[model samples]
Target: MTFENSLAFAQEQDKLDPLAHYRQQFHHPVINGQQVLYFTGNSLGLQPKSARDYINSELDEWAKWGVEGHFHGKNPWVSYHEILTPASAELVGANESEVVCMNSLTTNLHLLFVSFYQPDGKRFKIISEAKMFPSDRYLLETQVRHHGFDPDEAIIEIAPREGEFLLREQDILAAIEEHKDELALVFFGGVNYFTGQLFDMKTLTEAAHKAGALAGFDLAHAAGNVPLHLHDWNVDFAAWCSYKYLNGSAGNVAGIFVHDRHGNNTDIKRFGGWWGHDKERRFLMENNFQPMTGAEGWQISNAPVMGMAILKASLDIFAEAGMPRLRKKSLKLTAYLEYIFNQVVAMFPDYQLQIITPTEPEKRGCQLSIKLIGSDKKFFEALTQAGVIADFREPDVIRLSPTPLYNSFEDVYRFGETLRNLLSQSHH
Candidate 1:
């Protein structure tokens, strides 16, 4: 498809978009009676229009039934998380029993590590990526230290080649091999937040297993944005938040996937809680802990109904528009965005912006991270003032993500026009 730097081209693409109606399903923020052009779905997705009714139903149930709402409601709170399980599994390409929605992402990270990061004897090392989201870095560091090993010695960080912004697949495979002897676990972010690079999880998991290490991923940026074959890929364990691509409420409930082999094993050590107890005997309250089978065994508490309601609304949308279909549109939309960005640079050589994200469609999601050559935040402020919602990373980077579910091709074109106009006027 030949690309053009014109609004007509974008509108034409939108006219042909199969998922174009999905834009109406979300509640984009309004500024001065007009909808802001949103591109932060990589950070927090716009709330689904259905979310209000979904949430209000729960609220009404709480008001009417009191404690009885747990067992009897439009959707029972007792098994609320289950409502999300099947679709969540389909989203990640996992078996139904291998996934569960529960605690926040960091909390689940800790719980998953407890079972998967059991270091013993000489195999006490962990390998991870450098510049991982700060929370993940802290989690790994603290977990390593908790096991009586120095973080510096126990955690090996794989970084990009000296001059590059993305990690090389070969370098990652070699790192697994290099640390094979002492490595107990391999952990990484599924899609890097800063560079928007999608690591090859399937290859990474295979390498980790070959090197005698367990593999895990924090899929905050990858979960709903990209296709995952967790079961087919034989990934050991993974976790992700709903707020970003999934569009659940902000800082909402998170979910996890444990391969059936691990999830079915009741012998694995875990920080158990009552909600994970065998449901049939849970009311009996036995002193002995009998865990449920599969990923349900990881639940620490009863589900958060409000957050799960929002998630349910969002997942229903995904179920209607399947991941495969979404991916099909995503590839074309993102390629078009990249093309327009290139056109901007071509039209104005003085703009001085470089796309730090990988050019391969297979290597990235919707996000394109731009490195501004100048240090000022004025450009970002200008974007905000003009009602374009993107993100700014400290000092140097800006991230623009055009979500396939709600963003149209015209949004991409307008973004280019906005930036080009702002820069041109500022220079004048």
Candidate 2:
């Protein structure tokens, strides 16, 4: 397919897009009189227009029935989370029993580690990619310390070969094999937040199992952006935030996936709470904790109805769009974004911008992290002033994501146009 870097071409593509209508479902922010080209859905997704009604319904139920709202509301706060199970499961390719919407990202990671990241004497070290999201690093460092082990000794951080920006698959597998004897767990971001690199999850999970180590991923950037098969891949465990690509609202409830093997394991200990207990006996409130089967067994507290309501509104749209369709559109949309950037590069010629994200579509998602040559945050500020909503990582990377659900081909073309103008001005 020949790609065109023109407004007319973009509009034509948008006119033909099957997912184009979904854009109307979100509320875009206005800068002057026009809506800004939002590219930070990789951070906090745009709110679904229906979010208000979904949340207000919950508020209304609470106002009407007070405590009885738990069981009497239209959505039934008692089992509100169950409503999202099938769609949420479909989003990440897991069974309903294998996944659950629960605590926030790091909190869920800790909960998962409690059962999976146990460090015995012989196999105590954990391996992960270097320069991952800071939250994950902090979690790994503190988790190692909590187990009476020094982070420096217990954590192995893999980096790309010098002068490279992405991790080689072979290097990752080699590291896992090298440390197989001492490896207790292997964790990675499904789609790295800064680099936007989508790690090969299935192979990594296979390698971990071959090495007798638990494999898990922080899918904060990968969850809704990519089509995942967590259950079929035999991934041991995974955690993700809903706010990013899931479009579940800021600070929304996160999700977790525990494979059938572990989800069914009654012996695996977890941080128990009343919410995780069997629903039939939950009101009984026995002193003994009887864990619910599957990922639900890891829940720690009651559901946040408001957050889940906003999440439900977003999930409904996703269910309607379907992950396969979303993934298909995303690949083409993201590729066009890259193509536009390349066109800008040729036009500018003076700026040293290079896309740090992998050129391979399968190795990336919607984000294209550009390494802006010889520029800093001020460059990002310039783009922001021009109504660009991209994220700037320290040093020199501007991450622009053209989300298929909300962003149009016109949006991508306009962003490229804005960037070309900005870069040309900077050069002058």
Candidate 3:
């Protein structure tokens, strides 16, 4: 499909878009009495309009029933997290039993590591990409130290070749093979946060298993941004935040995925709480911990009702729109954004604007991470002042994610126009 860098063309495309109506479901931020052009779904998604009502419903229940809300209220607080299971599972292509909404992303990863990252004497090393999100880097570093291993020794980070922005697939596969003997885990972000490079998780999972190691992912950027099949990929476990593409509000509760095999193994070591205990025996308060089967077994506490309620509002939208359709629109939306970037680059031939994200649709999500040569945060500030909302990583990269759910083709085109104007002003 051909893309045009014109308002008329963009509007035409928007008119033709099957998912364009979804944009109405979200509350776009109004800056200086105008709606800002949002391109940071990779960071924080636009809030669903229904989120307020979702929270109020939960609030009203609590106000009416007090302690009895656990059993008497609509969507009982005791089993509230259960309401999120089906949509969360569907979002990541997992069995209902394999997924659960609980805790924050980093917290869930730590909990999962306890059960999956069992690094014994010889097989104590973990393989992961370099420049992982800081939270994940800290998690891995501390997890290694907890087991009395030096991070430099136990963590093998596969960095890109000199001066490159993306990790090579061959290099990643080779690293797994090279450390097969000592590798206890092969963990990665499903999509690199900085570069927006989507890893081939299925192939990576296969390589890890072949090397006799467990495979996992922190799907912070991938969970709702791209299509995933955690169960079919045979991923040992995975976790993600709900705020980004999942459209849950800031600091919303996160979720995790455990393959049926692992989830069914109630004997698996986990930091458990009463919420994870068998429902029939939970209130009885037995001394011995009787864990529930499936992903619920990993729950460390009761549900965060308000957060889950807000998440439920967004998940309902996802259920109505479905991943397949969302993914379809996402591919086209990103392709159009890349086309606009190319047009902007052509307009400013001397600006040295470079897209660091992979051009291939299969290797990336909606994010296009651009490297602005000879520019600083000022350039990003200028874009923001001009009403473009995007993400800036330190040094030079600017990430523009045109999410399918809320962002439109016109948004991409307008961004191109804003970028071109900025470049023109810089030269003057």
Candidate 4:
């Protein structure tokens, strides 16, 4: 459990791991002709070895089938997004009908909001975390103003207690209690991008429901990294991109989950398109707007076959390993990284690497956000030059994510060793 044991234990655990072979399935990035120790799956996942083949299949069909590809091609383009449903629903713990792979993350967030964020005079407020991803904060702020409310009074931003890196569950619950009367909706990132803390979705959903509000999540960071039960948790809606931890390519399609409870609610008010029109009468060209059954009803454009192909390859890998097994491996891998970090901190009294992520695995995914005291951009740039692929957030945090599918225990060990060397040479 200690740093000294981590290196050996990681190696031994790798030897016994059934999923160890998966590491070889990704194409590791080569920097300056040397392989880098990549720990940034929190931002962009490595390409799966099968990604090329999967994508090529679609290209081949497009070339051979041409105009007929929409209906008659091998893996018909007309319903390509359908192929991803079974795997995506399984990954997110939703019923097959409740999930769909469609547009990008932020776009899906907007669509879901259109349906769920109806504000009235007394209940025209939104509650979200203070330091959300900039896009989310912007979107929510815009939504409040669109509904004719002042952003300052209508937006209930939840900040961490002073000196705390993450929000306590109790505080989040209390915030809901305090603002329950005016709160219209609760939208939060499933895991905080900066702090890498995973909120308790079940508790959050229950609290929001008890307060008579709709609860939704942006799972961009949590999606392939954490196990989610959108259905059981009664989450009204959620969205995520597949590029991170899912091994899909950058800008690949994102997915959405709408609870089965809302499947046929036509009064929800959505911005509709032909794809969302009922498939049976889709070509009838009648102007009457009849929506599809579940989350697929939210689609606005035709399926992007190329993007779905990449996601299919990635989902196939996830289906093989299953999340329960991957999460177990993930915990050990991240704990080893922390063990090494703790040792380095103890060895140098003046130097410090403070972990901003939650201490408990249940409250976080694979990422550990380390605030390097007295460190700067130069320090992070040096790590990149040294073939360590961790990401640097603005100000002082460095994020390292030891992805369970690809990162080894040795990777975490080497990163800590390199950081130790970097600190010892500093003029403290």
Which digits, one per residue and each the tens of the lDDT, describe model 4 over residues 1-428?
44464467667777887889999999999989999999999999999899889889989888898978898877899998999999899989999999999989999998898999999669888888998999999889888888888899988888999988888888888889999998889899999999999999999999999999999999999988999999999999999999998878898899999998886676579989999999998889899788988998899899988888988988999999899999998998899888888887788887666999999988899999989787777878988988899999999999999999999888888887887787678735
Give the Å shift of residue 155 in candidate 4.
Answer: 0.9
TM values, all candidates: 0.98, 0.99, 0.99, 0.97
Q: Can you list the residue pairs that collide in candidate 3?
A: none
Q: Report the C-alpha lDDT of model 1 over 1-428, residue by residue, as the tens digit.
A: 99788999999999999999999999989987777889999999999999999999999999999999999988989999999998999999999999999999999999999999999899999989999999999999999999999999998998999889899989888888998999999899999999999999999999999999999999999999999999999999999999999999899999999999998898899999988889898889789778898999988899999989999999999999999989999989999999988887777777778899999999999999988886467888888888899999977898999999999999999988987888778879
- Per-residue lDDT tens digits for candidate 3, residues 172-266, read 99999999999999999999999999999999999999999999999999988899999998999999999999999898999999999999999
Q: Pick by lDDT: which candidate is best?
A: 3
Give the local distance difference test score of model 3. Answer: 0.94
Q: lDDT values of the candidates?
A: 0.92, 0.93, 0.94, 0.89
**lDDT tens digits, residues 40-83, model 2?**
99999999999999989999999999999989968889998889
Per TM-score, what order, best first?
A: 3, 2, 1, 4
What lDDT is obtained when candidate 2 is compared to the true structure?
0.93
Instruction: Please list the Cα RMSD from the true structure of every candidate, rounded to 1 decimal place.
Output: 1.0, 0.9, 0.8, 1.3
| Candidate 4, position 2, lDDT | 42
TM-score attained by model 3 = 0.99
| Total clashes for model 1 | 0
